[model samples]
Target: MHDFDLHAPEGANKKKRIIGRGQGSGRGTTAGKGNKGQQSRSGGKTYLGFEGGQMPLYRRLAHRGFSNYPFKKTVQVVNLVEIEKRYENGETVEPGTLLVKGLVKGANPVKILGDGDLTKKLSFKLVAVSASAKEKIEKVGGTVVSNETVGND
Candidate 1:
């Protein structure tokens, strides 16, 4: 077809329904919102879980059980392989050093995990060490100074 013959397909460009213009427009006055009460007035929509003058389901049911999420402790973990890559032979590995080295972040406690080999004789302070990781650190002449226990033995 020629460029001048181009035209939109039928029903593809229908005009939007004009509402609340005047009574002669058919959709005017009420604009399909129907007569009066909550929905008819401005900002009169009911909130979610709202029931018509009765107790809502969320309110009728008992709020049961306790949550330990509020008292839960969050710990940041680092592996031995990462320490061997970032730290020197005699340098200390702690939360602050780990943060500076981009191994861990935030103020949460740090826990070292024994995932790979460690050769440097480093010192660990103010951090927790897993049972397996502690053995690995001591074997490499590294020292772990914290008494805070991490995961289950």
Candidate 2:
């Protein structure tokens, strides 16, 4: 049988040596900080972005381009292939409908590009469509409600 009471493992649960107490602690005098300097003093923390009193990396790098226009249109894109696969013949596709189907998100305008063939005659109201997409939709006897029409109405 093992003697559990007599042999409590050596150095188990040893207390941490508290520094800066007195000479008895051995780590007293300089509190283990080693002779005085900038680091030995209190509140010696340096700013993270400090580059040893040199110019920061951000300032040194050259900024090349400038955007003068503040309000540039940022549009969400949907491909014609995705539309062809998702919608049925004679279906009315709109932004809200697309959102409901989890195809697009956010407040950005949606632009549809012609990437695949469409067999179904779908009537879609979109923010923008490629010239090929418009042609394809018209060729298939489908109605494409353009951004201009939407703006007019």
Candidate 3:
């Protein structure tokens, strides 16, 4: 027996208080805009960064620092643990193969770090390999091809 009929009566909703109507509307004349000056006139809206004639905030903040090294290399790193889990035994792994397998992306250099055990022998061409990773690979009868030397010439 709950009443869901709660609503404003017919025509009970007050009409929105309109501005800039005309002098006859009472809200006309200045259209409730008040007496002269910047705000009372038409097209008085200001820009977002404006501070009512004061210096803006953006210009007050400190700006510093410079970096001359523009061609710095950003190498994407992969650990041996991840490689061991994703790769198959006796498979040759390379940057292109890793990219095709969705293990790595882009032309960014790949660095392999030793973090887990390698039970399978894998021949890999990588940009960088840790000493431990290189040793482990060689111990497991795998080959490590360095990309840095290949890219230099």
Candidate 4:
């Protein structure tokens, strides 16, 4: 019903246009590609960012901007809801412990986020912990012994 929407009416078979089938279909000899040329031939595909034998837009534009992406470190994150489900009260939560629980694997930097309620008095030894998460953990008699130097955050 919208101007830009493409919706076929009910009972409309909507067969695809069979190009180069026959002349009766109005796509006969040329098939809308015109006479002999590179595009007219079968399997003649063009690579992306290609121009008509001219300099591409990417080449014409100035190479500007700097990215610190390569130097940036990726952080592994976990939520309070999941932590409560995995560990029991008075349990220690470290990166190695998280690996065993399938919460975080490898030596990737881990961060604890506070998004839900937690009642366990667990001990935290993580790379990073949000301010709210630390407050919540402390509120529940949990200890946050974080080493922020290990993570990018």
TM per candidate: 0.63, 0.64, 0.67, 0.60
In Å, residue 131's CA in model 3 sits off its true spot by 2.5
**What does the lDDT come to for candidate 2?**
0.80
Task: Please provide the root mean square deviation of candidate 1 (C-alpha atoms, Å).
Answer: 6.5
Distance (Å) between predicted and true CA of 124, model 4? 0.7
Supply the TM-score for candidate 1.
0.63
**Of 2 and 4, which scores higher on TM-score?**
2
Kindly list the per-residue Cα lDDT of model 3 for residues 1-153, writing each as its tens digit.
Answer: 359868877999988998778877778878776789899867988989999879889777767788768968787777788889889988888888778877789998888888888889898875578787888889989998886432211
Better of 1 and 2 by lDDT: 1
Candidate 3, clashing residue pairs? 28-31
Task: Go through the candidates in order and give the clash count of each.
Answer: 0, 0, 1, 0
Query: Any residue pairs clashing in model 4, and if so which?
Result: none
What range of 10 consecutive residues in model 2 has the weakest lDDT sum? 144-153
Worst 10 residues of 1 by lDDT: 144-153
What C-alpha lDDT do the candidate models reach, one value each? Answer: 0.88, 0.80, 0.80, 0.85
Q: What does candidate 4's lDDT look like per residue over 20-118, in tens digits?
A: 878899889899998998889999878899998799999999998999989998878898999999999989999999999999978988988887889
Q: What lDDT score is found at residue 13 in candidate 3?
A: 93
**Which portions of model 3 show Cα errors greater than 4 Å?**
1-25, 62-72, 148-153
Q: Write candidate 1's Cα lDDT for 62-128 as tens digits.
A: 9999999999989888889999899999999888889999999899888898899899999999889
Give the Å error, residue 75, model 1.
0.5
Please state the error at residue 107 of candidate 3 in Å. Answer: 2.7
Off by over 4 Å in 4: 1-55, 149-153
